[model samples]
Target: TFHSFSLILSVGDIGYYDDAGQFYIVERMKDSFKCMGRQVLPTDIEAVLLSHADVAEAAVAGVPHDQYNEVAKAFVVLKPASQNKAIRATENDLQDFVAGI
Candidate 1:
């Protein structure tokens, strides 16, 4: 009917802490990418994608690149009406977006 201190701390250390050490709930952890040796936040990308009328859901990931080391790859789920929407956006588009951040 008892538990060690290590077990208690381990069970409670599941969240994000900022520089100030304030804890916050993490909705998702896989939604992160590293580009040009920097952490590219996905919430920004998701915000932009959501702004577009066609995009329903978007998931982004870092894909290996021969030159850049890693590049952002967006897996978008489009609305039914936009199913036929072409993949007009290119890797350059994502690069530009990340750069602007």
Candidate 2:
């Protein structure tokens, strides 16, 4: 709190894209996550996760965090090959890649 100058800011928390060539922010700031003190875009991470060979589909969501403010939680669907072979990427490797970004 800033002494003698306490204030609150309200901001959009959700976003959407339309076929009409427009995108909109639709939700609250407290619902979002900051990666490296910058907004960690959910769509961006979804794209990255889907790019992995073993991943068939992925959904990224923000998890509550006391330090990072928030962290990403990915719910993924595995490819047939990956499911059969049980192939998987190590958590360290994924974290390293994301950390590098």
Candidate 1: 10-residue stretch with minimal lDDT: 1-10
Best by TM-score: 2
lDDT, candidate 1, residue 87?
A: 58
Instruction: Supply the global lDDT for candidate 1.
Output: 0.56
- Model 2, position 31: C-alpha lDDT score: 44
lDDT of 1 by residue, 1-101 (tens): 12122211222222455655554433443555577788776677777776666567775556677776667666676666645765555446645654575
Q: Which residue pairs collide, candidate 2? A: 12-27, 13-27, 13-28, 14-26, 14-27
User: Model 1, 67: alpha-carbon shift in Å?
Assistant: 1.2
- In candidate 1 the C-alpha lDDT for residue 101 amounts to 53
Candidate 2 Cα errors over 4 Å, as ranges? 1-32, 82-86, 90-101
